[model samples]
Target: MKTLNSYLSETVINMKPSGIRKFFDLAANMEGVISLGVGEPDFVTPWNVREACILSLEQGFTSYTANAGLYELREKISEYLFKRFDLQYDPAEEIIVTVGASQAIDIAFRSIINSGDEVLIIEPCFVSYAPLVTLAGGKPVSVSTFGEEEFKVNPEILEKYITSKTKAIMICTPNNPTGTVLSKKELEAVAQIAKRYDLLVVADEIYAELCYEDEYVSMPSIEGMKERTILISGFSKGFAMTGWRLGYIAADRVFARAMLKVHQYSIMCAPTMAQYAALEALENDEDVLYMRKSYQRRRNYIVQSLNEAGLFCHMPGGAFYAFPSIKSTGLSSEEFAERLLLEEKVAVVPGNVFGQSGEGYIRCSYASSMEQLQEAMKRIKRFVQSL
Candidate 1:
C-alpha cells in the first residue's frame, strides 16, 4: 500500500501550512468569537452590481467566456485603470480577467519564473506569494520592512537582494497585515531598481481604492515602468465583492499573452457572472467611494482605540487592518493572539505569520461594524491590563 504522503509533489511536501488557517479553525469552533482574523470586507456587494450579475444570468449568459475574459469587461477594466491611475493599456491584447488577484499572482509566477529563478517578495507580505513562487519552481527571497517605516519598501532593501538570477519582484500596497501604502517617491525608487536590474514587477494593488490618507500609487504610473510591470487588481477589496472572485492583470502585450496561455490551461475564464458584476462596478465609482469612506472611519477608530489601550499602532494609510505592536505584553505574537482568543474572546492574527519581520506584532482587521470594533477594543484593553 502506498503511504498517504507518497503522492505529494516535492514542492508541496516542502511547503509550510498557511499560518492563517490554524487560527481560523480555532475561531470557527469557539462560540461567540469576535473575529478580526480574516482580511475580508464586511460590506455586501452594492445592489446595483449584484443586480447586473443576476440580469446576466437571467439573459442566459452562463456560458464560459473567452479565455482572456469577456471583451467588454476587459475594456471596462482598461478604462477604470486609466481614469484612476493614469495607466493605459489596450484592452484587447493587454489585459486578462482572472479568478481573483490570487490567480493573477499564480499566473504571473508561472509565466515568468523558470526553475531556480529568484523572486523578490517584500515582507511582511500577503501569504500566497512565496508558496505560489515555490510551486512555479522559483525561490522566494524576502526583504524585511519595519513598522516604523510604515512598512514601505526601500530602494536599498531591493538593491540588497537583487541578483542576476532574480526574475521578478512582488509588491502589495496598501499592504495586507500592515495596511501600508507605498508613496510615489517610494514607487519611483522601486522602479529605478527594477529598471537597473532589468527585473519584472508584479504590483498587487487590490486595495488601491481603500486609501485613507493619500492617493494610491502604482508602479506602472511611473515613467518607463509600465512595460515592465504587471498590474494585478480586483474588485474584491474595493467594491465589497470578495465573493465575486474576479480580478485582472494589465501589462505589455507580450507578457499579457504569456499569462493568457497559463490562465487558459488553469482557469479558462473568470466566473461569467462575476465578470459582468465587475464590469458594472467599473462603470459606477460611487459604490467604491462609499465603501472607502466606511473603511477609513473604521481604520481611524481602531488605530485610536489600540493606541489608547497601551498597544503601539501606526495609523495605516490604506487597507482595513492595523498592525499593533504587542511586545510590551511580554508575550510573543502567537501567544498574545492565542490568549486573546481564549480569554478575551477576541480573534486576531499573529504578525509572525506574515514573516519574521512580523514578530511582536498582531494584525487586527477593522472590517466589522463599529460596535464590534468598540467591544473588541475594550476586551483587548482589559486583556493587556491583565497581562
Candidate 2:
C-alpha cells in the first residue's frame, strides 16, 4: 500500500498550518477560557436576513445557482456598491459570487499567479494570504507596517520591494489584527505605485462598513485603478453574517471570467440561500449602520481598557480588533499569550501569528460584549502585574 504521506500535493505538504488555529485548538477544550482571538463578529445574522434565507429554502431555492451567481443577487450587489461606494460594476460580467471573501482571495490568486511569481503583501496582514499565495505557486513577499505609523503601508517600502516578477499586491484596509484603516491619501499613493508598475491590485474591503471615521474607499474607485484592481468584499463582516459564507469579487470582465472558470471547477457557486440573504443585506442600509455603531462602542471600550491596563494600544478606526504592544510585560508575544491563558483564563492572539514583525504585540477582538471586554481587561492587568 502507498504511504499516506506521499499522496499529498507538494503544495499542500509544504504549507504550514495556520498559526491562529494552533492556539485556538488548545483553547477550545480548556474550561472557562475567555477568548478574544477569533476575528468573527459575535452577532447572529439579523432576523430579517435569516428570514430571507428561510423563505428562500421554503420556496425550494436549494438548487445550485448560476456559476456567476443568481442574476438578481448580483444586481443587488452591483446596486449596493454603487449606492454605498460610488463604484459601478456590470453585475452580469464583472462579478463572481464566492464562498466567502477568503475564497475570492484564493480564486484571484489562482487566476493571476503562475509558479514563482511574487505577491507583495503588507505585514501584520490576515494569516491566510501568504499560505494561499504559496499554494497558488506564488511567493509571498511581506512588507512590514509599524504600529508607530498607525500601520499604514509605506510607499517607499513598497517601491523597494517591486520587481519585474511581482504579479500583484494584496491590500487589506480596516485590516485584521491592527484594525488600521488606510487613509484616502495613502490609498492614492498606493494607486500611483500600481499605475507605475502596471501591477494588479487585490483590494480586500470586507470590513469597509466598519470604518469609524471617514467613509470607506475602494482602490478601484481611484482614477486609473478600476481596470487594474480586483475588489474583494462580502456580507460576512458588514452584516454580521459570517456563517452565510457569501462573498463576491468585482473585477474587470477578463479577470472575472478567469476566476469564474476556477470557481466553476471548485465551488460552482456560493450557497443559494445565503445569496438570497445577502441580497437582503445589500438592500437594507439600517442593518449595516446599526452593526457599525455597536462595533464602534466596543472599540472605544477595549482601547480605553487596554490603556488603563498599561498595555499601549492604538485606537483602531476600523475593523473589530485592537493590537496592543506587550513590551511592558517583558515577554515575547507567544509567551504573553500563553501565560495569559494559563494564569488568567483569558485568550488573545499573539501578533507573531500574523508575521515575524508582530513579535511584541497581541491582538484582541472587541466583537464580544462589553462585560466580556471589561473582564478580559481586568484579567490582563492582573496578569501583567504578576509578570
**Most accurate candidate by lDDT:** 1
lDDT of 2 at 241: 89
**Model 1 agreement with the true structure over 1-387: per-residue lDDT tens digits:** 899899889888889999999899999999989999889899989999999999999999999999999999999888888988999999999999999999999999999999999999999988899999999999999999998887888788679998889998899989998999889998898988898989989999999988988877788999999999999999889889888898899999999999999999988888999898888888876978888888888888999999999999998989899999999899999999999999999999999999999999999999999999999999999999998
| Total colliding residue pairs, candidate 1 | 0
Lowest lDDT 10-mer window, candidate 1?
Answer: 149-158
lDDT of 2 by residue, 1-387 (tens): 899998989888877888888779879979988899989999888888999999999999999999999999899988988988889999999999999999999999999999999999998999999998998889999989998887889999999999989989999988987999998899999999998998999999999989998888888889999999999999888889898898999999999999999999999888999999888877765777888899999999889888888899999989999999998889999999989998898989999989887879999998898888888888998998887
What's the TM-score of every candidate structure? 0.99, 0.98
lDDT of 2 at 191: 92
Worst 10 residues of 2 by lDDT: 280-289
Candidate 2 similarity to native, TM-score: 0.98
What Cα-based lDDT does every candidate model obtain?
0.92, 0.91
As a whole number from 0 to 100, the lDDT of residue 203 in candidate 2 is: 94
**Clashing residue pairs for model 2:** none
